[model samples]
Target: MNKSNIYQCADCHTGSGTPQALQAPKVRTHLPSVTNYSCTDCHSKVVVNAGPTAANVTAHYAIRPTVPTSNYCDYCHGPNATSPFPARNKTIPQFAHDDPGWDGNATCRTCHTNSSVSADPLANDTSSFHELTTEYGDAFNGSVKADCVVCHVQKSPQFVAAPNPPHDISGMAAPDCYGCHGVNVPGTEAQKLHNPTPTTTGGCIACHSNNATRYYVNKSLFALHANVNTTDGMNNVTDADCKTCHHGAADGTMGMKLGAANSSNTYFCQDCHTSAGTGPTHPSDPNLIKDGLSHGKTDCRWCHLAGDSQPRPLSSQLRYHPNGPRGTAAGKNCLSCHVSANLPDPPFHAPGESHVSDLNACQECHSNADNHAVTPLTQNTPPLVSGLSVSTQITSGTPSQVQFTVSDPMLQIAAAQYQVTNSSGIVFDWTNMTGTFNSNSVTINANIDTSGLVGNYTVNVKGMKSAPRTDPSKPYYPLNGQWSSISNAQLNVIQPTGYDNGTVYGTLGTDIAGATVSTNTGVSTIANSSGFYSLSLTNGTYQLTASKDPEYYPNSSVFVTVTAFTTITQNIILTPKPTGNISGTVTSK
Candidate 1:
């Protein structure tokens, strides 16, 4: 095969600004399954420097042609190929069973055995035909053809008529299909600017649009609201867990049902932001819903509508606001719509913008026209978090303290959250902790539970302001300062050692003295004269192996779970060596 000449690294790198090491050809890693191959055997190699004058070269790096006349994979797997031997002749249906719109009646020969090259797999199949094995370099693993199920479920095609699950996920719980579907929600602050809407049409919009049923399934809420485990002393929460908080006979009665935070007979928001606490202050009058609570608007659509101009109930105002305070196009804040200076296209105001010096002052002076409130308004500014300190070392299944200082400009610090995330990015939000607050700077010290956890982790701290209430019957707003809190520190959790005591025996139930008993983690111990072995191992599950050399075969399949500071008994029985050699074979020789 005549191959096209390519450019060597030295062609471009031996120039003025290039490093000397970039001048040489790199050692290529050939597939281990093949042998006695060299550069240009399957593909071309670097020859001249990269330039317009170079023949048959386009760029400094090798970029495969968009359309190639030949299939390199066919060289080995083709019907008449011989070098690597043709692949097994496996029969496959023209259309897979799971292919969308397939009716389950077509035969394989319709396409495979047809004379038309376009319809024949033997004549047109290429190296890039299968994605897992072609694009990702994954082994076919005996699969005759690429399995679509590797990405989407092939069996549940009835859900959507497609290979994947149905797009409607209204009833799905957390961590189920969330690995692929729920997780695809837009992650960046900028990408999350859409107005939240409620829709039956699933995908990310179903939840991001503020569909209450689908909202809590977000992975980020797992630490705060979702029941992650039983050890946390919380009930297991399902997709319908919303009823746990919203099903009270009355608004005030609902707030008290949540158990923690003494907010009896008060609005639900006050559950975490009690009036007596340091959280943001809540308005006092239930009748003042127009001016004080709902910003003088009975219809929630006005504030909630965005670029689409559609009033989407339960949708977010800030997210859908075509122009937000962060320099979008227009602003959505009270000053943007109320203050005379802002006018038609109220300019964007960044956080801590000097344009509105005092929040309370703006609330008192804004006019009462155009459904505007005539009374004072309140807006929450998150608390400032700093001086975060966590116990640098601790043991698994133990409790430790995570301390951080919080200060709020508008109200007192009410609640704080401490999150511990491992290297794998699994966040553990420590809930149900007793918090102590002081006057000058609220210092939060939470008892962190480290059960079933051992490794390096990052501790993040954030604080919220007090919630002052005007009326117990009205909805209380919760303003969280989590986005501003960036204070973090490292923590290391180690497993406490445990003892493993057991006896090793042979197949005949006789003690196997001096037997070697070992753990899968490499810790080992030898049995004494009585065949009793004792090993000190860290808290974890281990597979034990027992053997006495020539007398018995090793038994390495015994499993045991070990806890910290506890001794567990696990007896390992070794199989005796097979007896009685073949004497008849020698006589025949």
Candidate 2:
């Protein structure tokens, strides 16, 4: 390791000597003619004061290469274990040939060329020492491993000092596929052997066995699995292969237990992955299709994409929808996914029945709006008859009738029925009731026997839709179906000549037009201007009183008597209180 040169290139370069003196070449190093050396040992000590020279390798000229022959200079300058370039002499300026950063380990033909090129560079050549320059150049390439440690290391490219002992790699990482099949190239083993893959020609048990190299990494199983390349040359492993070679296999029938009873396996996939369906109402419940004949055959994502639970139609699978599988905006497609038979009227039958026609008409008899549940039409809404009115006076010799309007909100009522309650407490259905279809109003002749009495009668009217029930015992004569809604009116009977009617008149004040006049019989009427009021009382002596305001003196009751059907007059005035109005505005800052 001495800096002193035996063949003194300094003498030829700058040490005051010979033919090479005029030009200082970039390289100058030689072997001492007197020193012990060998052509077999390319590493024979000859420090490069300038660099390796012809004198240094002159001994290897006549030598023939042996089997597995390689570039001799690589032993000292390449990336091999024996390469001492890393710790070379400080002033020598480390390098192989011309370039200061030259790499001595590369395919020889890259720096040396011939047309007889073959796969093995060393075996293809047979040249003399002087033929070295003509056959081989001093060029360099950096694309490959700078030094040949990529091939020479055999196990790993990571170098370590010895005597303290290099790490065995055994406990570094455990059960990793890349631990043993590690590669730095960017391809598969089948593509390039130096490249990587999860492949193991001997199968899963081969690397997982006692004879396997015990090495590992600190990464998680998922990360390792995600990065594993299962390309060509991968171990021919299958479920059966694992079971056949396993001493302890996964237990349980429906659920997978990946080891002996409780002993968990390193393949910690949690048995079931937790990533597929994660929404709160993601339609992932298996029972959402409890008795589903077809819908139970797919993953939830097929229908619940973007979280809309109203599954789109996969008509081919269920055959429920007439149209082929298709999706609608925001999952509002309802009819295609629904195929239930429910109706609201009698002959109440399921759909696809003999009586049921167009399925689209479901809404006519049931709740059919999108997102709505099926509810019976009759139960949800009812037809109603309102705006009832009747003629008060029964004409002595003319026919009389009751007129009223009907509003059928449900449109279920096609006809109406009525009953007349007379003073005798006997109720009879109005058999002569006729309705004008367009206006939806009914006209029924009261058929009042004007000679019976002089009192009030009741007309009860109702609306209904025919129920078409098959049972003969059911009430069917008057009308059918259920009464959607009901209402009533009053009919008054009066004799124009026989009984005597009397009128009483009175005055409460000067400006009381709306003051009420009443009798104990519950008959009441309002007063006109000048506070003069009148009422007709039938054959009875009546006691009447006038109404007064809160500030007026109380009224004095009036008594009036009637002898015949004539007008009887009784006038009275209400007095006022002693208090007077005191008005003013009071303001404060």
C-alpha TM-scores of all predictions: 0.26, 0.22
For this target, which candidate reaches the highest lDDT against the unseen true structure?
A: 1
Tens digits of per-residue lDDT, candidate 1, 1-589, equal: 1134544432432234235355443322232123343323333333344667555533333432232333333333333333332233211111222222233322222122222122334333332332222221332233432222332333231212123343323333333343333233444311111111111125322443343542323334333233322343554434233323233312223321112112232223323223343322333454322323334322232343221222222233333212221212233454444332211121211112123444465644445323334443344455588877788589887877788787755444445676788868756864433454323247778777888778888887766544333333432222322234457888888887888898888778888899999888898888999999998888689888888889788887899888769999988888898778665544553
lDDT (10s digit) by residue, model 2, range 1-589 = 2225333343443334556455633221222231222332433333334456444443224234331245533332233564433322122112221211223232333333321222434533433222333211222122332122222123222211101101223222222223334332343232232123322334333433432222111112222122222332233333333432121332212111111221132221112112332211222344332221222112222232211222332222221111111212124332332222211211111111122345557566554543223343323344466666666777444344656555443232335666778778845664435543322223323344445455677878775433332233433223544454557777777644322222223233346555666766676676665566667666567776666556455454766675434666666565666777899999999
Instruction: List lDDT for all candidates, in order.
Output: 0.45, 0.37
Which residue ranges in model 1 land beyond 4 Å of their true spot?
1-382, 423-426, 429-440, 466-476, 480-483, 500-520, 524-535, 539-563, 567-589
Off by over 4 Å in 2: 1-359, 363-377, 430-432, 436-453, 467-478, 484-486, 496-589
Q: What's the distance in Å from true for residue 492, model 2?
A: 1.8
Q: What is candidate 1's CA lDDT for residue 64?
A: 28
